[model samples]
Structures are given as C-alpha cells and as structure tokens.
Target chain A: MKTRVETVAIIGLGLIGGSLAKALKDNGFCREVIGYGHREPSLRRGLELGVIDSFTLDLDAALSAADIVVICTPTLVAAEILVDILARTEALEQPPVITDGASVKGNLERAARSACKEFPPYLVLGHPIAGSERSGVEAARSDLYVNHRVILTPVAENSSEALALVSDMWAAAGATVVQMTVARHDAVLAATSHLPHVLAYALVDALAESDESDEIFRCAAGGFRDFTRIASSDPVMWRDIAIANKAALLQAIDQFNEHLQQLRRAVVEEDAAGMHETFTRAKQARDEFAAILAEREQAKTS
Target chain B: MKTRVETVAIIGLGLIGGSLAKALKDNGFCREVIGYGHREPSLRRGLELGVIDSFTLDLDAALSAADIVVICTPTLVAAEILVDILARTEALEQPPVITDGASVKGNLERAARSACKEFPPYLVLGHPIAGSERSGVEAARSDLYVNHRVILTPVAENSSEALALVSDMWAAAGATVVQMTVARHDAVLAATSHLPHVLAYALVDALAESDESDEIFRCAAGGFRDFTRIASSDPVMWRDIAIANKAALLQAIDQFNEHLQQLRRAVVEEDAAGMHETFTRAKQARDEFAAILAEREQAKTS
Candidate 1:
C-alpha cells in the first residue's frame, strides 16, 4: 500500500503539516515523509520530533523528490507557495499530485487558477476540519485527523487519479473524505468553522476591553471557557482565513447578526415565549448535531 | 459543624436543588435534607435518589421545619419563590437563612425587596458558577459545586449571621465564596455567562434555520461542539435568564456587536493587520483566562 507513493512532502511544518507527516509515516501511506517550512527552527523541531524523515529548504528539490505534495501553510502564504510550486513543477517530467490543508478553498482555487497559464490538473484543494488551540510542530500528533472530516474542493480540470490519491492519503491518516465544489466548501466552512471563530474572538475581545473585564473573566466558568476556547487559536492564520474567505464569512456573520438582533429584541421586549421558541429550536438542533457526531464516532469504532 | 443547621430545605428539586441537597448531606452540613418542588414526581425522584431525606409540596411546613433554605429554581421562578418564602417566614419565630442559586441576582433582589415592606435580613442572593447541560434530580451530583465559585450578592439589609451561614453552606459543598454587590454581580455575569448563552443560541438558531443546516452541522467539529454546548441547556431556564438579566445582557450584546462589526469591517476590507491585532488580543486574553482557571483548579486539589 505504501508503494503507491514513494515519498511525501508536507510544507509549513506547523501543527497540520507536522501532524500530516507523522500520520503518513505512522500509517505507511508513503515510504518517506519530508517537511519544508519558511522557518528553519520549525523544520529542525519537526525533524527532532521525528515527525518527518528529512527537512528540505528548497521547494524545487522537495517537489522533485516527492510523489505527492501537501501544502499546510496559512491560507495567504499557501496561495503564494502553491502558485510557486505549480510553476516550478510545470517543467517536471511527472508533476506530483498537489493538495492543501487550508480552511478556505474558493480564494485559493482562484489564485491557483490565475497563477498558472493552464491550471494544473493534479492540484487538488482540501481542508481537514481538524485542529487544536495549540500550534507549531511541538504540538503535532499522529492521530490529530483520526475520524475527522477532510473536505476536498476539486476543480473540473483536476485529474481523477490526482483526486483519488489525495483522498487516499487523508483516508490513510484516518480521516473521512468528502468532496464538493469550491463555492459549497467555502460556504459550509464559513457557517461551521469561520463564523464560530469570528464569534469567539469577538466575544473575548469585547469582554477584555470592557470596564468589568477582570471580574467578568474571574466569574467565567466551564461553559465560558469552552465557548471561547477557539479564541486562543493562531491569530495570523485566522486573520488570513477571514480575509481569504471574506465573502462567505461576511455572509455568515450577517446571518448570525440578524439572528442575534431578533434574540435581542425578544429579550428587550420581555417576550418569554419568543425567546423560549428560539432557544428550544437551537437546543433541538444542537442535540441533533451531537447525536450525529456520536453516531459517526460509533461507526468509526465499529 | 453539621449542627449549624438542623434541617436544610431545598426548593425546586431540579439539578441545582438536588445537587445542593446531596452535597449538603454528603458533607454533613445539616442533620437532614428535605426537597420541595411544584411537581411531585421531581420531589419523589429527589427522595428516591437519596438526595433528600424527605419530599414535600407544602412549602409552609418545609420552611417551618428547616433552619436554612436554598432556592434552586429557574431565574424567573426563583424571584417569585424567594418572595413567597420571605412572606411565609415573616411571622415565624425563627426564619431560615435564605439563599438562592439563580444565575441573575439583580431581579431576585428587587423582587425580594418589593415583596415585603421591609426585606428580611436573612435573605442572601447567590449565583453558583457551576452547572451541566443535563437537568433534573437524575442528573444531580454531590460534587457539582466542588472547587466552583459561588458569588454572593447581599444587600445592606442582610444580617452578617445570615451571610455567614449561607457562605458556610457553600463552603461545605466545596465552593469558594466571593462577595459582590447585586449590580456588579449582574454586570459581570451578563458579560461572562448570559452573553455567551445568547450568542450560542443565536448561532445555532441561525444555522439550524438555514437551508444548508445539515451539511453545515455534518462538517462541524470539536470547536463547534464546544461553542454550542450551552445551546443545549434548558430553553425555559435560559429564556427566563435572558429576560431577568435583560439590561445588562443587552448592553453586553451591544458591545459584542460593535466588536463584531469592527471585525466584519476588517474582513470586508481585507485588513489583515486589523484582523490580526483583534485576533491576537483575543487569543492572549483567552489564554490568560485559561491559565487562571487552571491555577484555580490546581489550587483546589492541592
């Protein structure tokens, strides 16, 4: 099974990149796993942690040695690095199947399409819906993507073989792979991931800057901590995501704001029935989501 | 220490009430624990579970027998119940030191004041910063308040002995007690707990009402689960809380909306630097809060 890909290169050496390298090695998805990052220290740490078999400074050399390339950098940086990789790989006798682990897909797809004269058929866009508040190579783990959702937004021009390889790589990492258009991927992720991130950050920032900040935080309990847990995520990466998925994110924020306004009105008017209705619906929906997640976990174990 | 109170009466027999009864009995805070509720089944469940030594629907008899009373009903119902208890105990030879576990303090305090020409000095207002999504006597636990914060908001009229008795009871339940004015408690809680609940409910409601709800929830991961965990909380309880803490909640919501608008503007303009700053501050703040909570937990066990 590992012979399908002799070597795999993961760019960025961050949590996702390092985790992917370790998962690939642990699952025997590839014969060797190499890591590349903008920072030499992170690459060194990845090597020290045994997340990768080797580290590469040169993108061209890394691409040349690998059967597949996984871009795991921030969304903005990923776009530029991906474009550069496409350009460098264009002259290769056999270009490797390329994929990314960015949170947003639409902007990356457009950027990739425009960067090359003819969009590469081997470029498969993907975003694994898995991460923790902790970042960098030190926090990477082999089981980070186990039973997580990995969404691939492949363009019409992408080769079936390339898509299959990308899908198989993630599957080997213990992720469940699903495919959709770039638009659909961005929209769904905006609603599920990006919007929640925005809300958490905004809530924390608002409270932190308030007059009663100290007391507010002191009284905050388990629910408050869990609600704002994502606010501790990597800021620069989130910033990039917010910008790259601007349209979908903005739409999500607007919808959320409108719903909040309705709730606020009910609170102000002392409309108990209205508030109860909204909260009941939300509770039912959240419970349903929890049930589905539990079923998925059970299915995976079974 | 157990002789401080001969018999403790818990009103509501729900999660908080049942848990308090169990904790009180487990810690020898009282000779016996008695439960009262509007519903006979819940009171029966409390007695059957041994959270209470006896069950009663007759509040007058329960009040007459108990040395201390803990009100553990919903926010709205708590206000009315506290007032009724005060009125019923007004002519008694010895009134029980009364305290409540309602989330909001201001409304309850006002109701207690208005229900009697002169509020009883034995009445103490409190909010325990502990709960689970689960409800009712079946979900009650003896350790629910262990190492948790319990905020006490005593008015000028509250007797020092009454305050001490209330504080000692919570301490016996393993809670750390803090004192604050009703206004401060309400403001702090609105910023911390109530606003987060509103946001979670609104976010879930928005997504649930959307056409892409199923797909959105399908891809939702750990962050989403934690973010919306409070949305599954009791709808009627939360609705009552929203109305009870309307002013402060509305103010918190407004501030959050302003912060979110700034974030929205940054996203719309692709202001990477602005977004990064806001996200960085939020991350730092959230991390600090988490560290404080960890320290508190460590302190408790040590």
Candidate 2:
C-alpha cells in the first residue's frame, strides 16, 4: 500500500538531508521535494543540484504544505526542532506525517510525545546507518545509502499507513529497512561502531603527543593507515554519539579496557603461552567476522 | 660503491627469506641464491618458484660456499640459528658477511657478537620493515621491498664493508635504507606497530567469546573491519615480538592506558566537551598522517 507522498519536506540540508533529497528526487521516488536549510549557501547548492523542487528557511511554509516531513538536523538539536514544529503547527486543521532521520531515538520520542499531545499523531523514528568520512551537502550523493541498513523504531499501536509510507521511502532510497527497539539499536551500535571510534581516538592520542612521534609516524605502515582512517571523522558528531549512547558506550569502553589490561599483563609477565592463546582466539574471531561480511557482499551482488 | 658477492644463503623460506631470495636473484643482485627452510614443502615451493637456485637441510652445506649469509627466521629462533651457523663455520678461512633480517635488533646484535667472535669479522643488523599479512614462501615476491624502509644498526667496530654490502643489497631491492640505533628502533616500533596490534587483538578477543558476539559483529561497519584486520595476523610471530621488545612495548602500553583512562573519565563524568576535544585532536593528527601517506604515494607514482 504505497501512499502518495506528493511533496516531501526535508529539513536541515546537511549530509543526511541533502543526500535524501538527491536520492529521492533523482531516482523519481518522490513527485515534489521541499527543502529547508539553516545556511543560504547550502540551500542554493541543493537547488542548483536539483535535489529539491523548492527551498526556504520558513518553518511554517515548509511544514504546512508537506505531506511528509523529514527532520534531518544535528543530533543535539533534533529534539528542539521537533518540539518547536509540533508546538507551532497545533492550530493547523491538518498536519503532515512527521518522521525524523536522527541517529538516536529515545530523546526524540520524549520530545515528540511532550510537544504533540493534543495534535494529530504523526511521528516515525529512523536511523540510516550509512555515511562517508567526507561530510556535508558538497559530499552528497544519491548512492550513499544503497545496500545499507536503515533501522526504523516505530512506536507501538502506531498508524500502519504512516509506517508503510516511511518504509517505502527508505526502500526507495536504496536501503534495507530493519526494525528494532531503541535500546537494542543503541547497544548494538555501541559495541560495533562507537567503541571502535573511541579506541581509535585513544590510540592516536597516545602516539601523537609521544617523544618518538616523528619517527613512529614516518614509519607508520598500511595497517596503521587503515586503522586510523575513521579517527579523522567529524569530532562533534562522535561527541554527540558518545553522550547519547552513554550507558552502552561506557560498557563497551569498560570491556575493551579489561581486554587491554589483560594483554598488558601478559606482556608484563612474559606469558608467551597465554599471549599466543589470546592471539589465536582473536584470529579466529576476525576470520568469522570477515566471512559474515563476505556473505553480505555476495548477497548484494547477487 | 657496489660490492661483488658470489653466493647468498638465506636460511628460512618464509615471507622474509623467500622474498629476499627472489629480490636478490631476480635483480641479479647476487651471483647464486641458496636457501634452507624448516619445512620440506616450503623448500620445494621456493625452488619451484625460483626463489632459491638450490636448498639443503644440512646447515653447513647451505653456508659453506656463501659469500653473504642472511638469517631470516622468526626472532625467537633467529638468535639460535645465527649461533649455530657461527659455531659450524667458525673455522672457515674467510667467513661471509653475516646479517639477520629480524624485527628486533638488540638481541640479534648480542647474539651475533657473542657467537661469531671466532668466525666472521663482519656482522651487521638489518630490518626491512615491509611485508604483507600473508606469510610463507608462496606469498614471496621479488617486489616486496620496493619503496619500503630498511633500517640498519651497526655495532661498535663493525665491518664497514659488511654494512655497505648489506645496505647496497637492500637498495638494489628498491628499498630506502636508513640507519638507526637499536634502542631507538625498538622504541619507535613499540608505539607505532606493537601497541596497535595489541589493541586490535584485545578488541577482537573481547567480542569473539561473548554471547552478544553475533549482534555486535553484524552491525560492525568499515571502521571496525579495518581496525581489526591485523588481529588476524600470525599469533606466534606477534607473541615473539611482544616478548622480545618487552620493555619498549610495556612503555607503549602504559602510554595507551593513560589515554584510555582519560577517555574513561570523560565518559564516566558525561563530559561531552572533554570527549569532543580529544576527538578533535585525534582527527587533526589523523589528517596530518593521511597527508603524509598521500605525499609518499604521490612521490611513488611521479
């Protein structure tokens, strides 16, 4: 049941919003796309690229006409934007089906529930887990979300039509839609994504300020190059992730710390046998992980 | 000045030895190449691949007619083999210039000085810090050393001719030869290479044996994959490295621990500002590192 979402409003034309605009418009997945950006230059760029049918910073004009509104602001400001939109639009006879493209969901849920108490319910939570280290509207591309996972966490007893429309939207953008609870999503991402970033940051900090920094950096090989590539990602974005997924990210950090301490103990004690066993287990685990990735890749190709 | 060497003996047909054999023979850098591998299959493979002109299990036969002998075994076994070769060929009228292609240099220097006292007057320590994750003679290639660094450490009163010959061999193999003190090399590698391997191994070990392993791994993206790729490297080899460079590696571990503690404190306190600062510094450092790598790549292409 594909509902006709004639005019889709995309708020905050940064990387995610700008990309969505391009992907949906270029693929002919949407009829007319409306865009709202904080900066005038980004709005102009999106318009020049034909990613949006029209653009404005006027929240009322964008929201009143939208059949489907997609919020794509920074993580820290996502809640505020949603609350303001819901509050100001309460007098309207009919409101758009609201969906947010924020990474985290728990805070968004609270903000939405508080602001839209008496209004027609129209809220969907989604996280598109795809990106490049290069960011912003200049880095926008239609194929960024192709073959990536886009997890949607809809509230219980929600409008099935709205959910279907949101699912179709992501599917049209070339993403696989998987549903999960907000808590589960945060924990999984903490272990898989956030922890790696934290460790990479720590490793770089450990080496950069050291005495042999120049020598070690000069001789840094291919292994080091790939391992630290993600450490160059936008810092403020990671800072928000660490705070938003505070509990799970802390658990992940603790787990890695324990592992590191054990390795250090092995080196300190010169326990060759113990160290060898640890390495063997690590090797086996990586092989298994690689196999899983290979299967996913094969599936995509096929 | 290029020095003439009639025969070169490489003991061990694994990645290092087999690669050195191929590079020397393919480029006509040496008159004849002979090898000794612990495994029969590897010896056969090396001969079949033309990495060695001939090979013998008898150690003396491999070393008797050699003008230059390269011991390319694991670091743990490197000392013992160098000692055994010197004892067997101590009575030679004119011993060949001896060099061992080992990662660690202090132990090799001590062993070479102690064992070859009655034998070769020429001893030099060399480390060609270039290789792929793949090991064994099958992975050996003539271009393994191209555009890579080869560090040389010469002891007090070490033969200038021996040092010159070894340097020229590596240079002819397309490596940029650099000289460093043994202690400095160990310290530099400890921070740049050893610590990262330890962190990668620990991170993999933390997840490989857990119940949440499947979920954690499923969500892992490109960053996690690259960071853990080196965790799949040979355990025995890494174990030897951790043991041989214990002191320097321990210092590096301590430094990394301090950084980890800082991150832990920030997370525990929910200090977003602190975490952002740390990540910003790391991002800048990685950018600088990437710039360096890109410059080197550009130089290679041009």
Candidate 3:
C-alpha cells in the first residue's frame, strides 16, 4: 500500500498554489493542506474557499511540521523563498522534501542547489502546465490539472524516493507526469508558451498604435479575441517569465521571424502557391495536435 | 420608412449564407428566403434544416424572381456568380439591386462594376464581420450576427437607396452597420483578420514540422488552442482570402516581422528595460481594445 502524505505545506496561495491545495484537498491525498501567503486577505480567502485547512504568513511556522512543501510563487520570488527555507532549516537534520511549482525550472534548480548544501536530495523541480487569465485564490479550481501535463526535472543524483513522491503527488491530482531536462523544459516552453505571449503582446501594440486603430478594433471578431486574449494576462508575471526564459525565447523568436519574412515575401510577390503552402501546413499541424488530444481523451473514457 | 421586402434570395448555402438565411427567417424579416447551391446535398440539407425556405440549382430561376439578392459564395466564386447574373439579366428593365457578402471588397467591387455595367447604379458591397471555425449548413446559427459589425463599402456614386436597403437588412438581422471605403476596409481587415490567420497557420505548421512535435502537442493548452483555433478554419477559404488581400496582408506581415525582430533583439541582448516597455505597451493596447468592446457591448444592452 502506498503511504499517504497527511500534511502538505503550500507557500503562496495564488492561482497555482491555491489550485494545488484544492486538488490535494479534493483527492483526499492530504489530510491537512496548509496555505501561506504574503497578505492576510489571501490567507483568509484561501481558508474560506476551503482550498487550505489552515493558513499562516510565517515561513518557518508553515514549514516546520510539513511532510512536503510546494513553493508556488513568481520565479524570482520562488528563488528567494528557496534560499530563505534553506538558510533557516540549515541546522535541522530532517528538513522537508521541497519542490517548487514555478513555470521556469533552470534558474530555480540552480538556486535550489546552491542554497541547500546538504540538499536532502529533496529538491524535485516541477511545473504544472496549467493556469487561468483570472488570477488569485478565487480563480483556482480542483480540476485545473486534470489530464494536463506536469513536467518533472529532477537534478542528477537526486533521491529516487523524493522524485517518485513528487510524480505520484501530481498523478494523484490527475496530471500526466513526464520527465525532462530543465534546459529542454525551458526551450520547449519558449516555443509553446513564452514566445506566443511575446508575439500576442507585440501584435496588440502594433495594431493599437496604427492610424487605422479604431477600424481594426471595430472589425475584430472571434479570431482577434482568441489571438490577443493572452495580452490580458498579468503583465508583471509575463515580464518575469520573459526575463527568466530569455535565451530560449530569443531563439524561438528568431525562428518565427524567419518564417514570418517568408510569408511577407510571398505576400509582396503575390505568390498564390507560397501562401497556399504556408496556410496548408499550419492547418495540418493544428488538426494533428487536436487529433492527439482527442485520442487521449477517448482513451481515458474507454 | 424602409420598404419591407417580402421575398429575399440567398445564393450559396454554406456557413455564412445558411446563417444569414436562418437569421432573417428567425427574425421574421421576410416571407421566404430562397437559397441556391450548385451541390444537391448542400441544397437538400439546407432546406431540411430550415436554413433556407427552398433552394434551386437553376441559375436563372434563383435570380429572376427574387426582390433582394444576397451573394454569399466564396469571394472569387461570388465574383464569378456576379458576372453570370449580369450576363443573364442584361435585357431586364427593372433589375434587382445586387449586394455581395465577401471579405475583401476592392476586387469584388471591381468585378461588380465590370460585370453589372447595365445595372450600373444598383451594386452595394457589404461584409458581416462574424463567423465560426466550423463550416457548412450544420454550423449555421440565427444569432450569428447578433451585436456584430457589418461593414458597407459602397463605391462612390452608388445609389443611396441601395445602400440604405442593405444597411437596414443587416440592422434588422441584429448587426451594427458601419461604412468605409473599399481600400480602407481591406487594409484594416488585413491587419485585424488576415494577418492573424496567416501567423497562426504558420506557427502551428512550424511546430508540427519540428522534431519536438510530440512535446509541442502535449504542452498545448488554452493559449495554443486560442492561438491556433483559426488554423483549423476552412483551408480553401483562407487561401482565397490571402490571395485576394495579398497586398495589405503582405504589408501587415512585414510590420509584424519588424516588431518580432525588435522583440528578439531585446531578449537576445537581455535588455530588461526594453522588454518591459514592449510588454507594457502591448498590455495597454490590448486593455484599451477590450475597453472599447466592453463599452459597445454595454451600449447595445442599455
């Protein structure tokens, strides 16, 4: 029989942390899920929503008696929290197996390694690839990660048990756990996530500043809404993500620019053949992706 | 007071035509909406679904008896159909004023002017800025144009009665009609509509062709879905639009490429300040657009 983790300490009850708390609570995976937030209002709201059984603002108090601690703060804030946890718990012989739920992993992994010298081999890096445009505890949902991919990038020589625990926790919460190198994670996200946001933001800016701005807005339909919806995302969070994944995002942007130039050329030359090929390829890719997702969904139901 | 036309003719029974037929029928704007489709199956399905009161394959039968004619075929196909109509009705004394429903106006306007020389003063061009990814008569909805924009691009010296009749028809079907020059309409739509579809199709294709195809598919969520939803749109239809609006689309794509390169440079050089400014401007633009939409929606409800 698998041992149940009775207590989980979730630091930072924002969208991610609050979601994890709700998922853990609903699954009956943890008997007590505690939430810690910087502000009193969030802590109270987290409790009120039943995302967490208890709440606190003190990191030491929040971490002292926990079986597992998941830090779900902004990337830089997560790094600072990891350092603070290690500094305070340096004297303890038995510190919790800590993993962070930050989007970017490379920087967080390096910071975690550097701060926790005696590292219980406890630091398992994870990113639950799930979110909403609406933020905070109120927007958190228990099924946010259901059937979603949760990536684990454990450091070399990390304890196998800690890794399994993190993987199993996400599995229990209904995510498909996959393992990859931290660098690969960042690189992949640059194309799939980060770079798209940059493009969406930039496209919105270009159209808004143009002389035909009002006309563009007036004519925008569902397509425009879908393309620019992400621009409504938290600017600060996006800025942090952009800075953290700078290298990979820049590379992705370069590839996109080249492809975009080809489109421009085809358009300028009024090359029907080239335009047909470009849109045809895009249509095929999206259809194939939709097919894969639909297959997975079918398999689960069957 | 606007004349209440008892009979209306709708050519082509696909997504747009079918939806417009249903909208007009549901709103009780006309006694009957006659449809025409070259394909027997589409004609049968449209009639059975009540998307059209009846349909005919005979070209003259479809056009000669109707009071108002709405050409809802593909842009190029619609242009071809306009020529056929003009050739058949050349000897008619009181020909019905023709209005076309195509995305790109300049090309269609030119075609109308050339083909309908005998009925010179009776052509008005319109575009209902509303649609869905799903195609065919099955996807038709009566409320498809609810609170949507319908842009009218009447050529200079066109009859005011013709423009008023077209505008009133759309307004009665629950749309806000706006007027613009054909050149301005094409340029605005190139930025707001065509560029988005092109980029979406291109991005998805680029990712699918890469070795990281499976990983990209797995990581795609709401953002990817939203970004590439239009990529799954009718491929032939998009190809036609891209070709028709090639000039403006090319210019927009070039502008997007320039903006993308600027973003790439900021990321590559780790220019945090520059990145912040870019993101902030994009955010402001998106927010402003959203605010405008919200205001318009509020006005409609109020």
Top candidate, metric DockQ: 1
Screening candidate 1 with a backbone cut-off below 3 angstroms (N, C-alpha, C), the clashing residue pairs are none
- Which residue segments of model 1 deviate by more than 4 Å? A1-3, A44-50, A138-140, B1-3
| Model 1: share of real contacts kept | 0.95
CAPRI class of candidate 1: high
Q: lDDT tens string, model 2, B1-302?
A: 56557899998889999898898887888889988767888898888988899888888888887888899999989988888877877777777888888888877766766775432557788888888978889999888988888988876667788889999989888788988888888887887788888989998999877787886787677788988988988899999999988898998889888898899889888898899999999999889989988887776667
Query: What's the candidate order when arranged by decreasing DockQ?
Result: 1, 2, 3
The lDDT ranking, best first, is 1, 2, 3
Model 1: per-residue Cα lDDT over B1-302, one tens digit each: 34367899998888898888999899888989988888998888778789899978899989988889889988888888887888898887788888899999889878977888886899988999999868889999998998889999988888999999899999999899999999899889988889999999999999999888998999999889999998988898888888899899999899999999999999889998899999999999999999999998898779
Candidate 3 chain A: 10-residue stretch with minimal lDDT: A111-120
Model 3: lDDT of residue A44: 96
Which residue runs does candidate 3 get wrong by more than 4 Å? A25-31, A48-50, A53-56, A61-63, A89-92, A113-120, A292-302, B25-32, B48-54, B88-92, B113-119, B291-302
Candidate 1 global TM-score: 0.94
Candidate that scores best on lDDT: 1
Candidate 3: which docking quality band? medium
The true-versus-predicted C-alpha distance at residue B70 of model 2, in Å, is 1.5
For every candidate, what is the interface RMSD in angstroms? 0.7, 1.1, 1.5
Per-model tally of clashing residue pairs: 0, 0, 0
DockQ for the candidates, in order: 0.86, 0.77, 0.61
